[model samples]
Target: MTPSRFLRSALAGLLLAAGTAGAVPTASVPEFSDWPAGTAPAEVGRRVAENFAARSFQWQTDPKRRYVIYPEICAWYGALTVAGLSGDTALRDRLYAKYDVLLTPEGAARVSPDAHVDYRIFGVVPLEFQVQGRGDAWRAIGLTYADAQWGNPVIADGVSPEARWWIDDMYMLPILQVQAYRASRQAKYLDRAALTMAAYLDKLQQPNGLFLHAPDSPFYWGRGNGWVAAGMAELLRDLPADHPHHARILAGYRAMMAALLPVQGTDGLWKQLVDKPESWGETSATGMFTFALVTGVKSGWLNAKDYAPAARRAWLALVAHLDDDANLAEVCVGTDKARKTTKSDDLKVQYDFYQARPRRSGDLHGQAPVLWTASALLR
Candidate 1:
């Protein structure tokens, strides 16, 4: 037999021999150090992404109940990127089926009449479907949602949630606007995105270039800042070079990258509390930043000499978090900057509150950003 076939057969035999009652086969975990630099992110991304697909990208579920939720839908954003790059038809088909179920005949999400900005994040997937020639209605649904967001009283001040700005909106709002712009070629979509981002930067950006979680909060939460960085990068990617505010958005992106460079942990990750040295390293933020940095370098927006090492380090550190079966570890659960677990927006969470948040395995927050980073890396 050929060496490859012989090796596979022998390994299977050995695993069987080693099995005991109810014992699962041990996975032969590969070393990250051996992975080549140029293609490491994409290679690792494929493994983790496929594992996610097999499990249907849902963490815990009732077999009978299937509906799109915000978190998993966010993960699909990354998986869709990989699908486009790798041309993996099976993966793309599965995503299309889910999108089909989520939308109506006219392409609106199936939800209560009072759906909010949170629901609008689904605007992106339909644009993906339209590219495949089956999502025309889906594209309309996404555009209609953008109209709703523009008219929402919550953003009367030109940002989400009425009064105060939150870092999380960075990921949710601009992506839809950019995708809408991509689908319809409408300047209004791009105009709305730039206006909102400019408002956010004016409110939250600190002197050193990092952003506050909210104006009332003092802590620079890692993933929150990561959201801002990633959002700015995404906007610049689509915002035309001749667009009125292109220079301003690019400036904000570079400033955030400048602040991020010095704070990265020796291990190549950022802390849960970004400026707090004692806080633990966080995977999701690290992955997001890696994605932005690599993208910036590749796009000619960032200087390769200054940022490449940081990008490479961040990528490698992110890979180290993946387990034998491709599950990403140490992802913080969904949290806001609420202090003392109180009901008010002014609640100030203790430093330990961030440091102590539970870490999860295979969370979409972490998984999605990893794929984004992988897709950004040069093959």
Candidate 2:
């Protein structure tokens, strides 16, 4: 996360996202009506469920280049929540039972006992708490003091400032703290959430209406910001409507959604550079943004009349971006670390100069968001 490392990571992402101009997704999008009438939501859920079940992540064997914070819990939670809502009880049961291990000795350790400063904890709890009870999460915070390590002054990547941190942590942690606070009735969780937000809002926000992905990294990626947007919505849902920051949270989401609309490619996807699509484009970011806009409407945080069309448009764009297998192409895998050292060898090319070689789809950095997006799409 040093300055040198920042440039290399940003360049690596740029190299990977640069692609042959994809065909503009001008085909008239199939309507939701086109989703076979009477097609059970569970049907699609099962498809995604099977795909997620087959994927695995074991940190011990994983390379640093492949890491993202909360692969195991995020995938399981995304699979169940997105799939379960559709009445895919069987898949839901499997997912829930699969993750129920949180209560077991092994699963609890993965999400907790150390979640106070664990980045993964922020990402994991929403999916896990939303599915199972929040009991284990409460245990994690209760077992130890929250904010013991994270509150330390800036060290990695200047993320201690607001502008740089949002794209990375906002998507996961703040809301997790809110929920943990509510369950434990501990002030520390809320205190941590508020303190993080103050730092994030101050440094990351810009008049141009983008969150600094980080000080060293330059791309204002849609998925990363979208993670922040969606996380805020989820956080709002968890807090009492009377909370002082509630209105500010809605304003932030509105700003993000407005920022997204202008940069959307004619094809409905987002460019990797976000505002500068002529330079780069990516589907995963589009999907996450689409989810946020759509969910915002559903939650009454945004008006469907104003935002749903944009959401629908982005969904069609996302669908076109996916191949037959429901994967996002040109995703800067593990960016999912906006700031980390990138070796020169990371710049190897594939697609014959159209784009870098595809990282395996099982990559947690990509699948977690994809699963989260699919869940968003269904809801």
Highest-scoring model, TM-score: 1
Pairs clashing within candidate 2:
162-203, 162-204, 163-203, 163-204, 271-281
- Top candidate (lDDT): 1
Per-residue error (Å), model 2, residue 324: 4.7
lDDT of 1: 0.71
TM-score of each: 0.81, 0.68
Give the per-residue lDDT of model 1 (tens digit) for 1-379: 7554454344434433422122111121122124565346557767766765666423135444334556665677777777777777887777677654334643333442344545677667777666555657867977876676676545355554422367778767888788788878888888878877876765567766787765545678888888888888878777776777665566667768878999999999998888877789999999989888877777767666678788878888888888877788989898777452534454343555667789998887898888888767622
Candidate 1 colliding pairs: 154-162, 339-347, 339-348, 339-349
Per-model clash counts, in order, read 4, 5
